[model samples]
Target: MRLRSIVLIAALPLAMLAQGRRNAPPETPSTKTPAELRAEYIREHYTKAEYQIPMRDGVKLFTAVYTPKDHSQKYPILLMRTPYTVGPYGSDNYAGRLGPASEKFMREGFIFANQDVRGKGRSEGTYMDIRPVNPNKRGPKDIDEPSDTYDTIDWLVKNIPDNNERVGMYGISYPGFYAAMGAVDAHPALKATSPQAPVINWFIGDDFHHNGVLFLAHAFNFFSGFGRNHPPDGPNRDRIEMKTPDAYDFHLRTGALANYDEKYFHGQTEFWKELTQNDTYNEFWKSRDLRQYVKNLKPAMMSVGGWFDAEDVFGPLNLYKSAEAQNPGAKNMLVEGPWSHGGWARPDGTALGNINFASNTSKFFQDDIEFPFFLFHLKGKGDGDKLPEAYVFETGRNEWHKFDAWPPKDAKWKTLYFHAGGKLNTAQPAEKAEAFDEYVSDPAKPVPFTPYIANGMSYPYMTDDQRFAASRPDVLVYETEPLESDVRVAGPLKASLFVSTTGTDSDWVVKLIDVFPGDTADPQPNPTNVHMGGYQMLVRGEPFRGKFRKGFDKPEPFVPGKMDQVAFDMPDVFHTFRTGHRIMVQVQSSWYPLGDRNPQKFMKIQDAKAEDFVKATERVYRTNSAPSSIQLSTID
Candidate 1:
């Protein structure tokens, strides 16, 4: 629910921490339990303190600082700024854990600080979602995330006891945005920063919208709880009560986008209103694009994300590229693991759903990469020059790969073309005539994004089997023969579609899949008794709003039955299709409640009437002149 929520690294309780340590020795009737031992250890080793740290704008942010009890040596300050509460509230209450990930940071002993950014929790000043960075700060009043971070750091180094004049910042999701912002024209003491799965551009590619298409279920469910205003330091807003547990049915029955405000939100949620009004990629969205502001960063940086991250997949990849390009010669690195949203922070990262990576990838990242990164920059404890530019996990092969540059400099661009008889190959379509595959997209019977029913966006849907979707008449399927050798694909995928619609507009969904061989065996203890043979594992999928094909800011209606090009870049993937696996592609007009209904007519979809939602016959052209294909960056 709420799209797995923005994971708070230090929010893990003693009980949950104990539960995650599966191999820990069990407690006898007289001996202390793992939870008790951990709680005792934290209390003994750390001293907690609360502060109302003032920002440049005169607003005070609530920060909880946990310093090492052993004050023999000064420690670097590791800070995380979040809109979410930095709680356990009172000075007497101690967090079960500290740092960006794992108890390793706690054991390593640093001054851990977590702040509730402006407006949320006990913080003062109004909270603005993804606050636009102020490029020209004329006065102290001109404050943004960067200024607040600077103020916080200045205060910590000058006032906090037993502090080294060094600071590091890291956070996931919303806080990751703060972390990235802190790196821009960074404070002198802020030596290192990591923004993992940060929310970059909301309208383009992030939580709520993808290519101008509103992620209906995610936005709706998320805002239902997080979109409201409340008294400072109060509890989180209650989630909207759903009439039914099935999200697909509930969303569909809720009717047009207008119905959401009319029935549920009742114009109460300001952000939801903003989302509806800013349907196009206008200044409202552009100003909040973190990519443009990452220029000339000063801190040693690392951008982290999950290959199957359901949310914010676009953030880490593009942020890393932007920082690398803008900061030229800066110590910028990218780490992508075979994990879901915030998966690297979790105790286990061996698998997501049925796909297993065959290693404790999270532990590897925490111990080898993240810890070393901070140590080198913040504490001068490791070889900073040794870190790779790109540390990515290659799926299918389930192995880690380091590269001098992402997309690997040696990888070549190749196209996988769609052909007749559901065949997909590297060869260009030979057909001279207008050959195409057609499907009727009816709003009444939309294609479900996943096989199972849920009340919210299911995180596992990122890599779930696509057999259910492929079997639908409304979806087009194309596949290649089993590979003779491993076909490894790295970097972003580009979907270039030559298409036509009976209606003026439509939504095009593209999915890249790996088909397991018929002889493949099921997992050793498959509790669900799932068949592995012919499993169509979805590696990546993205939807494009047809109207925005020209540009995100420019929306144009399609000429019915006239061929038009709809091309967009999906997030990158590092995956290997082994010799026994077949590469598959599925294209559809509707991904259903995963994205709001298009109405198949060119108008403000948020204001569409029921009659505007009509059935449209969609065609994907694959002629010699109009070859529709997916461009991939592959390693030969």
Candidate 2:
């Protein structure tokens, strides 16, 4: 089975942004599709041209430019730089739709440009994964992402025909990283930037790793296709063909992490090799941290991400915060919606799996937030200053909320403590001599992150029902009674776990859930025949490697049967548990193939032998002296 196709269909937002029809009268559906109409429109009104734009370093990068044929008026340029192919290569071959994920932009007549980053596609140069930003460049050869972007914008504004000097950059996922880079040393013409779900740090909390834990399935599937080498003009390599359809079985059967290279990669994938070698947070990973380079941002900035983005949830939040802190008084804004990875770019954001968000959240972002952002900054058409500092979607409430600051300063911090009888409450637990919950974490039979069988990271898994996990013996479940009033959680969650393992090391997985009332009504269609009543919905979940409990840079072993602290902050959430809903917390040691299984020993996990994989009993203390709790930032 080729897992790449499955992952692409699930994770990527391939659908073109549908033309808004808010106030128009309903008409008969036409035979011509939206894509066809877009293509026709582009062919008639736009002229496509390809160029090998030269960088400061003599190397030339491939860029595709689309200028409006009706060049009677000057227009601002909207640019997108991506490692992914800027295909439909020839000048005659125009993209069906263009311009920062909206058809409106294309129709409104902005000069759109898409470029193949250095070393990818037709661009000249070797590609470095998450290329580190160079703070000091004495010569032309000391090139980085920021420098490349600066050069690209400089070339576009100077060489492009009949164009306004102003420029805006935007991209999703990998391209989003490039968009962020464009803002660092922004050109004089570069006025606006929106890095939607950008790739921030790979080793810390991005696509591959989260809190020092490798997201096994995501890393494997992504590397299978993207990690392979590509010639300057040759076709990219295909994804690996696996014998089994079940990724869980395949990964478990593959045994140790070392076996991956020996059996499949065979050291051909340089990035995977680097990942295995740098098992701990070291100089290699730290150098690629984008947060360190967010200082002195010049462009008007807007960082956008989904609250439940399966990938890069940590990126936009941290990127926004970093720019805000590093570049004081800069035009920095953040917009987080109730969608998946790049879901805001898709046509529909009404629902994910069985969870209904109750509105077209994506349309709202594009029309009201994103489009206006670019228009105001790049064209000086709208009042961009009217936009809030933070525009976030309230999940359970299914509504948009604007805040002067993220995690609203007025929001109170509350702790939900675990107690006997599987109870969770804000009140402190009463004194007890021996208060704890214990479970066996077996490497051979690790708990699956999702109940469904999938070959890669499932996009809907972020909000999938958690009842399947809650019923497991390995997962310890604790919940508060139906809330007396609505509980609104608005910011990051901190898990303060007092744990002990029978072995030297372990992994700690914490999940926040919303349990619906038993009498809740099911949806009308119910095609999947899902059970609505008493449904345990997963709001947010994260895995932490026990060794990194003290610090990401430091690794320590847990003394057998000795209590140790394993605390970490999870990504922010904007969720509300209604009055009839119960707030649940589930704690487990292993999340299976979603996160690579911990060897339960202190040695480097990437280099651990088969003998290191052992079963261990894990304990979560809930006494008056050593109580385990989750700190939540809540709004009134």
Go through the candidates in order and give the clash count of each: 0, 0
Cα displacement (angstroms), candidate 2, residue 122, comes to 0.1
* lDDT of every model, 2 decimals: 0.90, 0.89
- TM-score against native, each model: 0.95, 0.95
Clashes of 1: 0
At residue 580, what lDDT does model 2 achieve?
92
> Highest lDDT, which number?
1
For candidate 2, the 10 contiguous residues with the lowest summed lDDT are 14-23
Model 2 regions lying over 4 Å from their true place? 1-30, 229-235
Flag clash pairs in model 1. none
CA lDDT, candidate 1, residue 254: 90
